[model samples]
Target: MSSKDEKNLTQVTDKISAMDEPRRSTMQRVHDVIMTAAPALKPRIWYGMPAYAASASAPALITLRNDERINLALTEKAPFRAAGGVDGQLMPAAWYLEDLDDATETRVAEIVRSVVG
Candidate 1:
């Protein structure tokens, strides 16, 4: 990794480390899931939060932030197409996560994989 990328990773780690309770564990788990699902995505810090992107020059594909609730969001850069409402008219690009069970984690991994495509 480059020096700047290393610094960004450190900042993200610090941010995650500073979180309290379920947020910390949840973010860490989500981060792990994202990485495992899409190994090409590089982790970095964006807006003081953990973010992943194809490259530093590219827009972030995913970002994680935790406060009252944990948020896992896919950026506009991601191929966010979902088939639900009226021939895929309505789609969700972001999700609020409280915790991750096996099923939820698997779903999250699937989402990340789809986004990676």
Candidate 2:
């Protein structure tokens, strides 16, 4: 079983480790940020990706995707209040992440804090 076969991976770290490089490093960085920012969210494998949720019985609050791009997606359970929610306004629930610089890390931390709080 190769690491690329993420379906059978039940552990969060294993799944992230299995990914191909730059993606793998990016995912790992995101993983660290998420856990540090929102320690309440339990780490697990959800739909073959690294997912964080409130508990074993709760839905995932955030999920990371491993594709051509590293994707960060928030579930409906995440109370992420963006600057828009009006009739004609729209907010991005997901983002394709590349690098985790200081600014990006801060933003990610803020988002996870908001989600968990």
Q: Against the true structure, what is every candidate's RMSD?
A: 1.7, 5.5
**Residue 24 C-alpha lDDT in model 1:** 84
List, in order, the clash count of every candidate structure.
0, 0
Segments of candidate 1 deviating more than 4 angstroms:
85-87
TM-score of 2: 0.82
> What tens digits encode model 1's per-residue C-alpha lDDT throughout 3-112?
87777778777889899977888888888899899888888887878999998667888989776778888888888666776747767788887999999899999988
TM-scores of the candidates in the order shown: 0.88, 0.82
**Residue pairs in steric clash, candidate 2?**
none
Query: What local distance difference test score does each model get?
Result: 0.84, 0.78
Candidate 1: Cα lDDT at 68: 70
Q: Tens-digit lDDT track for model 2 on 1-117?
A: 334333333488888778888788888999999989977677777887888888765788988988877888888887755556463356557878787888988888887787788
